[model samples]
Target: MAQNHEIANEVLEAVGGRDNIASFAHCATRLRIMVNDKEKIDQNRVENIDKVKGAFFNSGQYQIIFGTGTVNQIYEEMEKMGLDGSSKEEVKSQAKQQGSGFQRAIRTFGDVFVPIIPVLVATGLFMGMRGLLTQPEILALFGMTKETISPNFLLYTQVLTDTAFAFLPALVAWSAFRVFGGSPVLGIILGLMLVNPALPNAYSVADGSAQALRFFDFIPVVGYQGSVIPAFVVGLLGAKLERFLRKRIPEALDLILTPFLTLLIMITLGLFAIGPIFHSLEEVVLNATTAVLNLPYGIAGIVIGGLHQIVVVTGVHHIFNLLEIQLLERTGANPFNAIITCAMAAQAAACLAVGLKTKDKKLKALALPSSFSAFLGITEPAIFGVNLRYMKPFVMGLIGGAAGGFLASLFHLAGTGMAITVLPGTLLYLNSQLPMYILCNGVAIAVGFVLTWVFGFSDKMLNEMKISGK
Candidate 1:
């Protein structure tokens, strides 16, 4: 522990004392604070704080970088001090008003999707495991083939692989409802209604194997299996409708009538109107995204990989979960995964370069662990504490990511799963493709290290850190 009380005291004062903060939260490597007044902050003083690698305002919060494990302690310290220790939900509601229109929209998208990533990630890993167990070489070693696989094993694998995509809309709707301030239970129920077994599955409809039911002989009703847009829209509409009903429904009847009317009205609207309309729109967006991914040679790789960290900086990278899920649902593999892993590698490598070159003990201490963490598939420590602090390092990371991404795309590389990346991503490429995965990561880290060593760090930065004791 880094003397929580002292660090908390320093953090509290740097953000202009406890009174200036509207709310506080921490992600992997930063203390994100919503301040009542930006004018109160002492940016220079905060950046110079001992153990703080960097500081900046982004996504409507004055974020001070403390690197992974340290942030958790500082956040708890602030709470122990009786400051605005709001839950993530409360902070989200308050912070929504601070960003520009586009920023707010992106934030909302993140709010809705980030919470559900763990669920999908777990499912994705299971799917990858299923694929691995059934690989031709592995099966041959066991004296079995796909046809000879045990039905019991196959059945379990199907559950592991299919369950997530089958109920994806429900997950999205549940998360979206929470983000939009609706009752999460209601959102979940509504999501289930959209994908009920009684209705024709969306995939069956897409494959032209099932006929859609005609509601009132006009509207088409189908299950929203593997769907995102329909559930997301339904969540928004249901939330707004619930808020409206709660206001008009009398206090005595609040519990009963509000639930009754909200569910009845929203479920009906979702099945008849929202599902059909938005499902079409979802298809269009999916097509466009696939077209970009399928673009000639390495353009998509260079663009997506180069700019991916910028998205991380904006805190809107969670939106890519939706895209990656959609890709997995449609293509049965995520081509974006290996490319993203490469980007993460570049970030870690740049941090490692700084760790090697820095003379200041404080800077070296920060960079080494942050770099190691980044290489393990978590980049926030490296990104916020080391690379982004030196503008040139961040740009070098981008170039390295672009180079790695270009090669990944040129080779038509893809991952068997989403979520896991950098070091852990090796499991995804465990089949005969493991060497390729290593090579791609090697390309990324090498370029990032060489470029950053040459251009990102300097004697001057280390001198500043030594003098200021940063």
Candidate 2:
């Protein structure tokens, strides 16, 4: 308790005292503060504070990393010292003000998609499990071939793995509406209308199992199962229209009229205009992405893997979320997930090497756990707190990432999922993919560890950072 209080006091003094803070908040692993003047805070002094692993200025706020549990304790102590606490949204609003217009648009897309990733991730795992269980070899051991498997059992598997993607647009739309400050229920219904059974399924139409309903022998209409872009566009436009209608309609009429007009206008535009136009554009983007990922001799893998962590440093990596989602929707697989996993694994290995090479006990303590956290797909601690603080290690990690990514592409490794990476990502490769995934990550770790140990770290480097060896 006393240690927390003392640390909080030191932080207060280091950040130019109470008068300098505009607002403050803590997330899962960092204390976020927006200051009246950026020049007032001592970055080095804040990093030097006990239990503070790292500090960086990002967006419009200064974020001090304190790992997971420790951050909450420090935040409680700071609150007791009379610093008013703000919600994360307030901090994000402050951050939103700092970036370029393009960056803000990317951030909004992130806001819409992040809430939907877990559902897709779970569906991917279920698909992987179904694949594993249905493998001929596995089924033979159970005295069953594909033909002998119970019809009900296969249907049950489909229920688990298929339902999420089947209704994915609804999830995307609901999230978009929430982020756009509109009624989520309305967004859900609007989305459901896109995939209603009355329309021909998009996949069926594409595969020639069913024909699309044509309007004026030109406009094609199909149920948007497994679609993303059209639903997102409709949700955004619908939310804006709903808000606009609410302001103009009388209060008594608003209750009845707002939703009626918003749905009618959006659905008509969605099916006839937005759906077809954006869906075609979506196809173009997906095709381009597929071509890049399929670039000869693993070039795409090397570039994306090597530079991905660099992008993370800029705090704009969430843009990949949309691309990954689109890949999953179109192809039923995500190659990007496998490639990024290599990048993450390399980062973990580089941080671990630094932890092992450093004689400073405090630095070692921070590095080891941070490395493990990276191994589990959370790399910010390892990246900002350990690897990037020493430039050579970060470069070594990037090289390692490139090497692993090359193997991932050469092996044609694609996962059944998105989001989950590194250790937890194994669930997405539970079939024939398991061996290649393991090999790729192993190469990344070895390359990262060897490079970092040989050239990236030394006690002198620590000395320059003023980190003392005990």
Candidate 3:
């Protein structure tokens, strides 16, 4: 354990003594830093500092990893030292000042969602696999007809899959409220209004009634269950409004009045303004996606196939998620889900290449399992621990990903829903176009593996460098 002041001083000094840092932010476990210049950062100094476990740089941000339960305290200390720890403001300003329109949009989306991705992926996989295991009827469709599919099993699977998604709006509201520096509870209340069944319906109709009573018509609000964007927008507004209301009210009456006015204004605006806009935006996004996916399947495949890893890294992969949820809600089958699986395969192939090329036992040991995990759609271990450490592996993975993407697209293969594991999930796409998606993914991985092995090694060069050092 580090003394509060000691950890604070160490972080300030490591980040170039407060003056060097432009802004700072902390997430669940890491401190996100921005400095005047990257060169001024002292990685070894920070890593050796008490309370900080390690440090690394990625996607233009410096990350200082800390032990469990320490990040919030460290962040509070940083704020006391006058560091601007508002990550949301920093991201919005940066996007406005820099990057193209598309890039800016992507950056904004990433800023809001990236911190929550691990939870989403883990929970998504957990629910997806449970559904596959327990739903014997689903299995029977795949020729596994030995066991009877029980209603209880089906109900349990629904509960498992539905739990995470059912609570997503509240989750988004909670996170976004925190980001905007407001009461998380208030945000949850607003989110619940959108999803909660207890809320009174605006209008009611009775069959064969002489007179119809319509309480509230032209109300554009829809159930926000499984929604991502609406709650985020409403929460952002609520946070700002809460802060403003808090400042105006007397300290004695502050709590009651603040929430009362905040909710009143926020709910009204959410229904009249934000909800409709985002609903339209969602439709726009869907229409645009439909148009793009309607392109020659090969061309669509080539584009998405190639860019999937890049999308994942930047954290815009959630946009692909919108398509999946929309399809599930409306059509019950999503075509783009296969793209993610192929992208994972590409990453795994690259990891395999690195494992084979490296003579270092440590590197090989790390790469082998990472590749296996990536094949199962868990690429963070492989991406951060393996491919990211070496330049060649990342490039190889991207190439392989593109190849697999193209092939999967070429066959117009789609998935029923998202899968936790890419390896077995690929089997889900088995239909008339199964062979095409499979062959494309296999060829892409194999080619990537072989190319990485041939080009990734540097035995002679490494030996020469070692000799020179001696």
Q: Which candidate's lDDT is highest? A: 2
Computed on alpha carbons, the lDDT of every model, listed in order, comes to 0.84, 0.89, 0.66
Cα lDDT of model 1 by residue, 1-470, tens digit: 25778878988998888888888888777888888889988876786667787788877777787877888988998888887577766666777887789889988887888787777777777876877788898999989898999999899989987888889888888888887878989899999999999998878887999989987899989998888989999999898888899888899999999889988998888988888898889889888888888889789889888999988888778778777888888877788998888999999999999999978777788789889888998887688777877778888999899889888877878886788899888777764677787888899899999999998888697677657765
Query: Quick one: RMSD of model 3?
Result: 7.6
Residues forming the 10-long window of minimal summed lDDT in candidate 1:
461-470
lDDT of 2 by residue, 309-337 (tens): 99988878888987898888788789999
lDDT of each residue in 330-435, candidate 3, tens digit only: 3434567666677778778888777777786655665776677677766765776556555667777777767777776666667645544377665454333456
Worst 10 residues of 2 by lDDT: 461-470
Q: Give model 3's TM-score versus the native structure.
A: 0.67
Candidate 3: residue 360 lDDT (0-100)? 64
Clash totals in order: 0, 0, 0
Off by over 4 Å in 3: 1-37, 41-56, 63-153, 196-221, 312-337, 360-393, 411-441, 455-470
Model 2, runs deviating above 4 Å = 467-470
